[model samples]
Target: MRNWEDIGYLQIGTSRQRQAHAAFERLGILATLNAFGPVLAGTIPLNIDLPSSDLDLICEVPQLALADFQLLLRQHYGHLPRFSLQETMVRGCPSVVGGFEAEGFAWEVFGQPQPTRAQHAVRHLLVEYAVLEAGGEAWRQAVLTLKRQGLKTEPAFAQLLQLPGDPYAALLTLENLTSAELRQRLPPLRP
Candidate 1:
């Protein structure tokens, strides 16, 4: 299983880079859900404004066979992005990819071999209902780890953090994802 830390380039942060990453991720999530069904377990994990490099989604996909999953993805997205899948350190896990494609957020997936363990431990910390409230420790750990491996964190995320009050608190203040529009995710609030 290859550790993301070993992948290295993940830490590179920039506005252009973050936008690419997010688009790739959105595609992956939509592809997976479209193929398999509703996600049984998953998290948006990150919402704060930073020059994000990749969007992260942690989920349990129990019923779908890998080949079928790939086929469905290809049909929907047209082709798979240039991504290399890595075997995870967790046993029984196959591989995860940091891939980019047109029309969606850049995404990374960690298919847990030991679903129970990863779900309870890493996923809990990364995807709890109050994930935004988890503070900077875990995120800092991820940032540092990626840096050690030569990756970059998004710059906008850092800029948001420097703002007064809780930077992401504004998100919590929203009653609905769409205050008026039927299907729209708002732009990140300026601090």
Candidate 2:
């Protein structure tokens, strides 16, 4: 696993980045994940994100203990506005999806079983790590810009960047492109 620096969390490109970092730090997301389980996935960890984008995260749990997980969320974030938690699944693994408002931003979390490739979270996490290692700031900038245009979801946003395939595949594809080329890359709107 890469250090926080290597993971690009220390980079502060925009106010949104600063807020996301501060919130994650104050909330002890990684610490919480460590206590309960592994972080199956996270979008903010990429270092470049839209101001309006909620932190997308997934954690592993003993099982899909939705009630217990909700208790934990309540313990840590009950005070947050618009807080809501429900039982769900991520790629067949029992899971919980929770949403809340904090620090003037929204946070969406999915807690699932021990991560596996079957989980979209796990696959996307791998791709995110790859992009961080190979794409650097250019990839981050390109992603952020694309996101600001209201193309917030993956694969679709990835497609617009013309990187290649879906989001995960596109990240893999984009990671290999030159930083200069990536910075200049323009996203297109389509199906």
Candidate 3:
């Protein structure tokens, strides 16, 4: 599997993935947010995205830099279609979320006062990737099917695995398991 941190792999990925690469490159999304340590996190990166999935980019913005971060996003993306920026509390911490449309995709830039890799989105992405890797193509299809039924990614996985409680928190429990271990928890593979 390609390292999720490096988007270069997307160039040779599925059609949607390639389109995402083109969109990102044409818009200079990464470079524009370089100062904030951006990491693309979401179904798009994992190749489990539906037609409506937006380009989700997570960034590390210190609390003291929140204003500047919001200003920077506005300066660069405010003119795009449906541009909107807001500040809110996420998981008890301040967050800055900006959305716009560009290069044939909806883009969301999420900023939190913490490292990108340490964020819940990144961690959930890693675990989801691991589960897909362990379960193989069939499991991938299952996830897509569940998504098409209107269940969010984490909830779909939780339902499939019969997990209890909050799906997001439950999914994290499998994060440290190896492929073999994950396979044991997953349903038996179809022949």
Compare the candidates by TM-score and give the number of the best one. Answer: 3
Q: How many backbone clashes does candidate 3 have?
A: 0
lDDT of 1 by residue, 1-191 (tens): 21321212223544544554455455545455543232222222333224333444444445345555444444554455754454444434553333443454445554443343344324333222232333334544443454445433332223323323542333233322232331133224332
* Residue-level lDDT tens digits of model 2 in 1-191: 54432324434535566676677777776675565544424555665555555776666666746578778887877788998888866447577888898766688877766753435655655555554445565656666666676665475346545665556556655444454565455443332
lDDT agreement with native, every candidate: 0.38, 0.61, 0.91
Candidate 2: regions farther than 4 A off: 4-8, 11-15, 28-33, 38-41, 116-118, 132-138, 160-191
Q: After superposition, how far is residue 164 of candidate 3 from its true place, in Å?
A: 0.6
Quote model 3's TM-score. 0.96
Candidate 3 has its poorest 10 consecutive residues by lDDT at 182-191
- What is residue 178's positional error in candidate 2, in angstroms? 16
TM-score for each model? 0.39, 0.66, 0.96
Over 83-122, each residue of candidate 3 has an lDDT whose tens digit, in order, gives: 9999999999999999999999999999999999889999
Q: Name the lDDT of candidate 1.
A: 0.38
Cα lDDT, model 1, residue 118: 44
Give the higher-TM-score candidate: 1 or 3.
3
Error of 2 at 103 (Å): 2.4
RMSD after CA superposition, every candidate: 13.1, 5.5, 1.5
